[model samples]
Target: MGKGGGQVHMGNKAFSSHSPSPPRNNSGGRGLGGGGMDRWTGVIHVPLSGGGPTFRVAASLIFSPAKTLAVPRANAILFTGDRVRGSGEPAIERLSDAAYLAGLLARKLAGEANAWVVDAACFSRSLAVYRELVPSVDAVGDPRRYDPTGFPASAGVANILAHCVHEIQSTITGTTMKDSAGIQDPNASMLSSCPPRTIILGFSKGGVVVNQLVTELACLESEPTPALSTHNLLVPVSASDVLSSISEFHYVDVGLNCAGAYISDHAVIKGIINYVLHTSKNLRFILHGTPRQWSDPNRPWIGMEKDKMLNLLQDGAQKCEGRLVLSEKRYFDGKPGSLLMHFEILQVMDIS
Candidate 1:
C-alpha cells in the first residue's frame, strides 16, 4: 500500500556525467550481462478473432477518479505479454487488438485525443498485420528483422525495449519529424512534432519488453554519454540521453501463464523484478491473473486459473516501493475457453 507519489526527473547534466562499461558477454544467457538463448523467441500461434480480447477479462480496469489525476503531462505506458502470445502470428493479432485498447485509454486520458501509438512487437507477421490494421500508427523497427519475441536472455528483450524507448524519444524530440511525411501523428500528423505525455501499454511477452525498456532507460540516465555522430544515421543514440527523457513507466500484465515450468524460469522473473526495483521510483506495475492452482505458491508466478494470479500480484504490490494496483479477478467463462481472455487484452485498448 505504498501510495506515496513523488517526481523523478532525468536531467541532462546527469546524462553528461558518467559512462558505463561496455556490455560484458552473457555466458549462460541468463544474467543482465549473460548470453543465453532468449526464451521470448519461442513462438506459439493463437487464432485472433475467435478467442475474444484478453484484456477485458485479464486486465483490471481503472476508472480515473475526479476525471483526471495530477500525473505527468508526458507519460509512457509500456505493455508486455506472456510467451505464448509473443510468436510472429499471435504477436501480430495481439498488437492489432492492443492498438484498439490503447486508443481507448488515449481517449479517456484526453478525450478524442489521438496519442502516438507504437507497435514494437518483433514478429514480421505480427508487424505486417499491425500495419494493415492501424497503418497510421508509428512502429519502431521491423518485427521480422528485429526479434522482440526472444528475450530475458542475452539482453535481447532489453535491447528491443531500448529501441522502443529510442523510438518514442525520437518522436517526442522531433527527431522522427525529419524522417518523412505520412508518419502517423499522435496529435495532428502521424509524426508527432512535439514531445507528448507518453504512455506505453504491452501484453504478455510485451510486458517483458516494457520492463527491459524501462531498465535501460533508468541505467542510461544514471550514466551520461558523450556526443556521437548524429550524421551517420543508423548509429545508436547515447543510452543515457534516451533514459533521461523518460518520465514515467507503467507495466500491465494480462493472462500471464506464469505457472508453467518453462514459463516460470527463474532468470525470466528475476530479470523482470530486478529491472522494476532498480528503475526510477516514478513507476507503476499492475498485474492481472487468475487464482487457480496454476500459480506456484512457492514462487512469484502469476497465472490465470482462479484469481490466484491476481492474489499473487497483490502480494508483490505490497513489497514494491512504487504504486501497485491489483484488479479484481474476472473469469472468462466462454465455451471456447480462456483464449478469449488473451484476445480481449488488446480489444479493451480502443486503438481505432
Candidate 2:
C-alpha cells in the first residue's frame, strides 16, 4: 500500500502544492529494484533503534506531525501461560517477567522520542483457562473453580483483555473515547495517530488463550449484543468499544494449539477477518516460533486443526488487500534436539 504522487484536496480546493518524490538513485546496487533488486523496489531497511531486533520494513504511507506524544504512550496487555500465575499467590513471579516485555515494547514504540509510559505493571499478569482440555495444569488455589476449561470461559478470557483495553482507553471522566477536549474532531486527518493502540502479547498456554479469546471476539462481534456478564470480567464493557480499541494482536510461541482451535466456527473466523478489515487502520499480527512447535500433534485432531487455522489466516490476508500486514518469523537454534524456542520468540517482535 504505497501511495504514489497525488494531489491532496479538501472540499472543493486542492492542498497548497505537490512536491516531487525523493529522487531514486536508479544506479545498480542502490536504488529500489535497481538491477537485481527489482523485488525490493519500495522496501527500506530500518535498524531497530533500541538494539533489540531488526524489523522488516515496508513502505509507509501515512505521516504524523512531529508533536510530542503525551502521557500513556501506549496500552499493553500481556497474557501468560498456566502455572505461571500461582493459584492464590499474587502472580508476582509472572509480573516480574512481564515487566521485561513491557520495557521492550515501551522502548520499541517510543522510537527515538524517548517517551514511553508503558511498564510491566501495565500488562495484566495472567488469564487462566480450561486446564484439562487445553493441556495445562492449574498449580494453585481451587483448581476446579479457577481453571478455565471450556469455550464460554475462553470467551470470558477474551472479554477480560477487552475490558483492560477499554479501561486504558478510558479517561478519568469515564469515557473510552478521549474526544472530550475536541481531540477526536472529525475534521482532523484520518491519518493522525489513533487513540492509544492496544498491544496484546501471549506466551505459551497464554497463546492458546489469546487465540481462543480472538475466536470469542469474532463470535461476539456479529452478535446484536456482546454480553459482558461473564464472571471473568470485573466490570461490564461494550463489545464494540473493546473490538475498536484493539490495534495489534500477537501470539508468541503459542504452543501446539496455535493453528485452529476454533477454525470450525466459520462465523467467528469471518468475524476476525472483518474486524481486521474494518476496525483497525494499521492493525498487524506478529507470530513467532518453529512450525513444528505450533503444529505439534499432541492430540489426534491437532494436525487437521492446524491446517485449517493456518489456511484461514492465509485466506484472510489475501482478502485484506494490503490493509493488514502479517509478519511471521521462525526462531530455531538449528541444533539437533533443541527446545522449540517458543519462549524466545517474544524477545523479538515477529509477525509484523
Best by lDDT: 2
Tens digits of per-residue lDDT for model 1, 174-245: 343333212223332212222333344555445444444443443432344455322212112333323333
* Residues 1-352 of candidate 2: C-alpha lDDT, one tens digit per residue: 0111111111100101112332123210111111111110112221212222221111101112221112132345555553343333333342324333433333344321111111111122443343322333233211122222234434332333332222222311234443212222223123314344445566555555456456555654455554323222211233333444455667665553233432345555677788667653556666655544545546434445445655767778788877666665666635332232444455455433
| TM-score versus the correct structure, for each prediction | 0.38, 0.49
Off by over 4 Å in 2: 1-73, 84-96, 110-193, 225-239, 256-264, 277-282, 295-307, 337-340
lDDT of each: 0.31, 0.37
Largest TM-score belongs to which candidate? 2
